[model samples]
Target: MTEFPEGIESGFAAARQIADAVLLEGYVLYPYRASAAKNRLRWQFGVLVPPEYTAQGGEHSHQRTECVMEARQDDRLAVELRFLRVQRRTVERATATGGFEPVERLELADRVLVEWDEAVEERIEILVPVEELMGEGVQQGFRLPGVGETELLREDGTAVGRLVRRREQVDGVVRLKAEELPGPYRAQRLTAVVENASTWIPRRRTPREEALPRALVSAHLLLGLEHGRFLSVTDPPEWARPAVERCRNEQTWPVLAGPDDGCKVILSSPIILEDHPKVAPESLGTLYDATEIDEILALRTAALTDEEKREARGTDARAGAVIDLAESMPPEVLERLHGAIRGLREISAGTPDGEQPWWDPGNDPAVDPERDEVLVDGHAVAAGSRVLLRPGRRRTDAQDLFLAGRTGVVEAVLHDVDGSVHLAVTVEDDPGADLWRAQGRFRYFQPDEVTPLEES
Candidate 1:
């Protein structure tokens, strides 16, 4: 085990908060009960099964993360790997001979305990100086031994039931290495490979649940720098863009995390996330299902029947906390969850008295969408211009593929507040072109995503 450098913990407070959510992102769903079919099939992201499982075409047995950083030879890098360890909890009833016998469920005076496979969070941290990584690099192996425990259930000194918990052994290795970039800037590329090197071998066609005990669930990495700053692999600078693109990340993507621009910390997750992802302040607590919105889940949790809530409480402690949170939430908190508006600012100066605010285009007299023109392929593409849509490869939406090679008439050439130009066009083949024109609705695209038709 490697000790983290001083101030590492406090410096990564915000990033850790988001990473915690990632660890338990899909641990459970809205219903939050063990019996839920969705809950039964768990650990969707960052699952590293045994090598034997991978050999049989199961999930990969390793995650590789490669990222860049601006650093000096003396700078230090710290890697923290986090994941979940599955623990099987079985309930047993007291036998007539004063012994306990395994059972599916155990009924107590006030509550019921059911057999469930729970998860225990685990983490491993290691630190290394950049100079060392730049030289020979480092490889560290870690192991978590299996554990078993039994708790006797007694009411007023009379035995009723018992709970047995067992955890399987898990082992892995973390390899860290760095290379100095060839550019003029002082930068280095850090490579980390986390592999499940456990000795457990799967039986022929073993089920996922049977192999999960030896697996790493929702595994992710939180990387920090002591005296250097990590670059955004998703949005690197022009000089570093080539290096960023050259970086290879397997089974995970690295993004900026932590407060204020996310330069100090990088969170490598199996689930894709935008740079500087934050846990919304309006969120009351973790629901263990990040796919669903917090408001909807909170409302749905509140609407659960008493029986369902009871089962949820028995399912997991985290689920019980969610139920309690929803039931006791104040009116104001619920209202806050209803909706939220962000990024609004006061209108800037030099606006007409009755004109629309600066947020709207009408406030700027010099800007005219219909009259504006953008140069595309040496031709002015403006209103009434026919062009073939050549959607960019990096277009955000997959539906853009459906519009590939389609023809459209430019309705307006618009400029956003961010200074980016957008061509608003109506599809020539769309039957609702007239209705779209009347409603002032148009599809917008960048200049590079369209080619001028030259009046053909």
Candidate 2:
């Protein structure tokens, strides 16, 4: 373990929220119960298995990240590697001979313990000077020792069962290298490689489940800078574009992190994210799924039956926390998670106070959904335009297959936040067509998913 200066450590902490989200991205899925088939296959990203296992076409054994940064001779770099270590948990029952036998389930007065695998968080930190990395670079090796523990499941003083947990030893190395770019700017390319060097060799044809205990799960890096700033790999400045292009990143990508002030931190993650990614303030806590909607998962967890909730609580401590959090969330907090808007533009110059804001379509004179037009098959399609729905362009939803070749009357042309156009149509023969039109509830399809029926 290594410590960073106060200023540097605080900068690193700014990136911790999103970094932890990536670390435990899919630790558990919705429903949170261990019986769910999706829950059985955990550790979805950044898994570094033993080299021997990966040689047999198993999950990858390492991750590499490379990025460009502007630095000075006196600048210092701090690196932190975070990952999860899988821990095998087993339940045992006491037999007539006073010996404990491994069992799949151990029921007690209050709860039931089931045999399942859990993750234990692990972190390794290193701080080095920029000049040191410019030459021979820095190499740090780490190890997590194997250990086991047992807790007796007792009733009023007599032990009826026992819970045992074990963790396998894992060995790995973090190597950091930096090279000065040949451009006019004082920029350097930094490369970091995380490799799992565990000595446990797998037997021939061994399954991944058996080898997971000795692997480094969900490995990622957090880099902090002192007296210098890191350049954004996703959207670097024009001068640094050439240097960014030369950087080769394997199994992971790097993005600028921390506040919009100088870029003093960079997060190299296995999960892809745009520059300056921030965890939503509305999020209550860790739901173990960052890619999912918080309100939806919270509602689903609250809807689980009592028995299912009990089983989830017994699965792992984190899962139990999730259950408690969802069940006890206040109405105000749940309401906050419903929706949030960002990047609102400042009010236009000299606009009246009672006028609609800039985000509202009515604020713009040229914006009118009903009269907007889109070109499909070399013809302009607008309101009241007859078109044939050919919903096979992308086919994102299964319902699209059933809507193929259906005739529709275009009611509006909608534009999304991403600048893509969509046509809101009402099926020509649908019984609810008039009702849907009146209520403004129309089906939306991309321009490419419809063929215009207008004359040339």
Candidate 3:
């Protein structure tokens, strides 16, 4: 005979044996936890033995045949068996659940159920046809046509039976019973295979080095009055010098005092470095004091880092815009404009002065008229009416003082039909009136020198 391939020859032989065993005795292979960490197998059965075979001495032969058939049934059996071995080893070495127990049997119609409860909290059950077990036994010589439903009670109240049939209406069903069985059955334990594989790996942490306290203490000691005052590090005034020294020496402290009453502080770190300082007494003068100290500390910390110095310089440049506006405006105008600009700058980066030009309504021509007439929107002028005009330079101060001071000359007089005389007045500058410093047209001047300007 030509040499057959080993794999093909073996497969054919295994299939032949399985067919023969099935024809004589029925067996059903059921899978358990094939996808689980612990692979497991189960066999359900229904087998029959011909009466003539039962009479012969062939029981052992049939038993061997059935075992061989089972061994060769599936290609995955080897892998399944290996998985089972690993699972068993894991269970045996586990800190939890490890032991074994007695087997139990149940019979119904054409099927038989075999079950065992192990000490490791596992229950294993198998169902096989009654005919398979009987045929195997008879083929090896024990004489009975087949196994049949016959009850055998255990020492405990639990019961057991065996059954066999060639063909019956109840071919597939097998029922099993056991009480107070330890669990975490073969089905349950095998589930760990997938769960373990899917678990997340934890991240490792870096080891931390100890901080040098002596260097920190030295830097703190060098902290000066100016630095301490701004950052609000008011440590008995005496401690100020030491704190700055400590900051300087250690090179790790990320913040220092601002220029105010030392209550404000600035972060030295790159992330928040370019932002403005946080100070308690807020104002240009107070902030200037705090920032000066902050800059000194920043200079020491940023000595080797050009990037940090650049960030600090940028912050200083932006802050200068606000200072320029303050110096240019009058005190009263500065106070009001600062209030408004402070709110605006919070919503935008640039100063309000740079955002728009200053325009005062007092300088608008529409609202002001010539001397001797009333003007409406700068379009029409009405003569002989008591009107207010912006005075010329020479008499502006006196005029303003007269209006504000409520004492001045009647530069011209107008008699109305109602007999109410309106006086046009000019007032000269008084040495005593510091308030009347600036000159204007609507202001009072000398009554004797009054010269009326014609309405245009």
TM-score attained by model 3: 0.13
Taking all chains together, each candidate's TM-score versus the true structure is 0.77, 0.83, 0.13
Predicted candidate 3 versus true structure: per-residue lDDT over 1-456, tens digit per residue = 223334333432333222222221101110111121221221111111121222231211011000001111111111000001000110001112332223333333322233311011111112222223222221111111212232233324433322121211111111211111123321100000000111112223311111100001001101111111122222323423343233221111223322331322222221122223332222332112221342332223324233322322222232223233333444554343233333433234344655321233234343322344422345322223333444344653553533443333333343343434334444434353334423322343332223334345
Name the candidate, 2 or 3, with the larger lDDT value.
2
Error of 1 at 99 (Å): 0.9
Model 2 regions more than 4 Å off: 55-58, 203-205, 341-389, 393-422, 425-439, 446-456
User: Rank order by TM-score, top first?
Assistant: 2, 1, 3
Candidate 2 per-residue lDDT over residues 1-456, each given as its tens digit: 587987678878888988999999999888887888999888889999999899774589889999988877788999999999999999999898989999887777655689889889999999989999978798999888999999888889988989899999999999999999886788899999999999888899988888899988889999988878899887889999888998898889898887654488899999898888988889879999877899999999999898888888878788989999999999999999999887777556545776545466555666688888988888989999999998874667777678888899999988765578989999989999999999999988899888888644
> Number of clashes in every candidate structure?
0, 0, 66
lDDT of 2: 0.87
Taken over the whole model, the C-alpha lDDT of each candidate is 0.87, 0.87, 0.24
Residue pairs clashing in model 2 are none
